[model samples]
Target: MRTKQAVAAFAVLLALAATSCDDGDGQAASGNSQASAAGNGGQGALGSDGDGTDGDGTVAGGGEAQLASVAGADELIRLISNVTTCESPSTDPEDTTFTGVDDTSSETAVGQESATNAEWGIEERATCDGEDGSANGHQLIVVSDMARFEAAFKARQEEEIAAGEGDTRTRWFVGKNFAARIYATDSEERDMLSLGTLGLNCAPGYTAPPNSTTQDALVDGCVLTDFVDA
Candidate 1:
């Protein structure tokens, strides 16, 4: 009886060891299979998870909608009127005193000594219509003592440049009377859309009407600090 009991106990121990080995082998194989499946799925491959992408072969990434340019000068006027102080067009406009390195033209004038030399406001100035008629171009005339605006604009330009913008050139001019900055445009003549000390001094290739003075050109029809490119 003692011998039989000992033999039974040995058999039970062997059975337990075999069960433990089988469980460990099954667990390892299951782990490897799961790891392989995860590695093969979506590892830089086109996604098939209905994620609204070209990966599912439906459509490309959602495209941006396009917008049209402002139609006429009046539309542009309406757009700007809400932001700037708009008054009846100035009957007489004078060149503001600008002191800066001009990237547009070589003409420079002595700073006007008077405080009332030029006023900063938006005026409905007449400009060429490109066809035969004339269009009312609302000119935002920026004058001296505009340090805050210039600082804000310059800071923004620097921030954009630091953020990898390589397409723009910002040139600032400082004068005793006032300072100015011109942003380059893609126009043929590299027309500038500028803000500050606008006047005949800023007008390089642009000429006023045949009978207009350099000063009256602002009111008549001139492109000093003009934003339009023909």
Candidate 2:
């Protein structure tokens, strides 16, 4: 789970623009409360391997970074596809199919960007930084693989079923409360498990109360920006 901090304003966005397209939207995203800093996407972090400016212009992050811009949405997706190429196929709880990176804009918001990952066949919502789904002016941090996503979603669904719950629609969403931890360290193989989980469980659109473990974990285990920043 990437740390959650309201940007106050587009202050950081302006900053990252100057430093390529870093946008600094990822500044407070370290330590325990956040996702793997935005660029944290490694070979699979980038959308595919698009040919446009990864905001970084270089389309090349030296370390194990998710290569922000990579090429364009298509190329970025292709790159992600290359790395996450699994041999077997799995069915999801919703009977939905996850193809991969269909909606490139879901990486971040643009107020009116089109093609959300939900539109695509992803098992879970991605960690797109584009709030409203814009391709630029914001950096998108998406997950590369989907295996873990299938498990998590299915687990959540099973949880609902075991509880004799009705209507899965009201139970899941694509965001999380502050403490939804994926793992102690980066696990790309699980990819964006926490991020996707957060997306599916926290948003208001999903009517279920948040998982108590998730909320308790967040409140009991960490400090929020409001406490530090305020």
Candidate 3:
């Protein structure tokens, strides 16, 4: 009977050992699962694909969207018109500063095909305070066909250069479908108008070639800044 009792005790020990091992394995599996879940949570916080891109492939922040905000003529005009401190010159429309240009004019025409263009003049005393004085006024041109406009613009520049009338002192801000000829004598006013108001990026001594297309011109020297609606 004692021997039988010893054997039963040994069996009980074995069963207990097996149960302990099973419990340890289950605990380890649970820990691993929790760790995997935590890792997945971290990835989810970073982005869907572990990068800064959303599920739709767009960047998480406004980086891609802002860069893609290429403004056309209407958008450009709206942005310029939102400037409350400064007033643009207008002859026909007293309230609006936009003056319709003759599409047939060489300076206003875009390409062989017809395109609409409008000009906005910014004088030194056009601001509210009337302190931003410049010897020459600034000009903004909004065009329908930027590509064709760029081509024609280069031709005009070539003609001016050939005639020895090329005014290199004038700073130009070339956008996607708009251009700003900044002649503000005041540096602060120029910055306020070009960089602050219009959000243009200019490169000194950089001009697109006469034969360059709009894409080529933008790649070479032209800048297309972000256009935020007012």
Candidate 4:
């Protein structure tokens, strides 16, 4: 899944557990990148496991809401897989200049980690499969800690340069707004469907309070903080 173009684009940039699907209008999954309002929207790559309709009428939440308590990984995947894209699609969701670091699958598949990327602490990566036993989309991954996440981002850019992915003209912008740390490959184009699963959103993007800024973009209640790695 690691391609030179996509990897180089995100050389220093980055989070979210696992995001996929979006309203890509022949473009982005749905051309809706505006992000969901709090729990109302979705992010990340939600596998086509569930559709939020449990044979009944109820909304299932992910990591940060009421739905999470009731839903499992499958439900989470479905939720992110069904969101709309941004009003206007970004220039290229595959901009790897900011997020270039790479790591093989760590194990979490795509469920919530231990708070930090290593949220499991030392849980020893487990093998998670959907209830149906079809491991097509359920794959949790281990996320890097805040410090490592930022560092790896920088390192990837250097690696890319060594490989001649882009030019020194590339730049990184750490916006003080809210945004998700999206994980994608070279050919991947993220829209709302997939973005929803990753959970890299928060009331748009805002600068974080001194304490809120961590490896992942955690918008503490509304205050935003953006960090560009390229």
lDDT of 3 by residue, 4-105 (tens): 999999999999999999999999999988887566542223334554444443334332211112344344434444432234442222222221222333
Candidate ranking (lDDT, best to worst): 3, 1, 4, 2
Q: Candidate 2, which segments miss by more than 4 Å at Cα?
A: 1-76, 86-159, 162-186, 193-199, 202-230
**What is the lDDT of every predicted structure here?**
0.33, 0.28, 0.40, 0.29
Q: After superposition, how far is residue 203 of candidate 4 from its true place, in Å?
A: 24
Candidate 4 lDDT over residue span 1-230, tens digit each: 56987886675344221222222343452334444433343544322336432222222233221112112323323332333211211222121111222232434322333333342121112122223333222222223233343343444544656687633321221221112222232123233222322222222232333322222333232211122222
Judged by lDDT relative to the true structure, which candidate is superior, 2 or 3?
A: 3
Clashing pairs in 1: none
Q: Which pairs clash inside model 3? A: none
| Root-mean-square deviation of candidate 1 | 23.1
Steric clash count of candidate 1: 0
Candidate 2: tens digits of C-alpha lDDT, residues 1-230 = 22344453466777766886343434644332345543343233332335322333222233221112232333333333332332211122221112222222343343212233333223222222222232221112233333333333444445555677533331222222111111111233234332233223312122322211121112221211100000
RMSD of 3: 14.7
- Global lDDT of model 1: 0.33
TM-score: the better of candidates 2 and 4: 4
Error of 3 at 227 (Å): 20
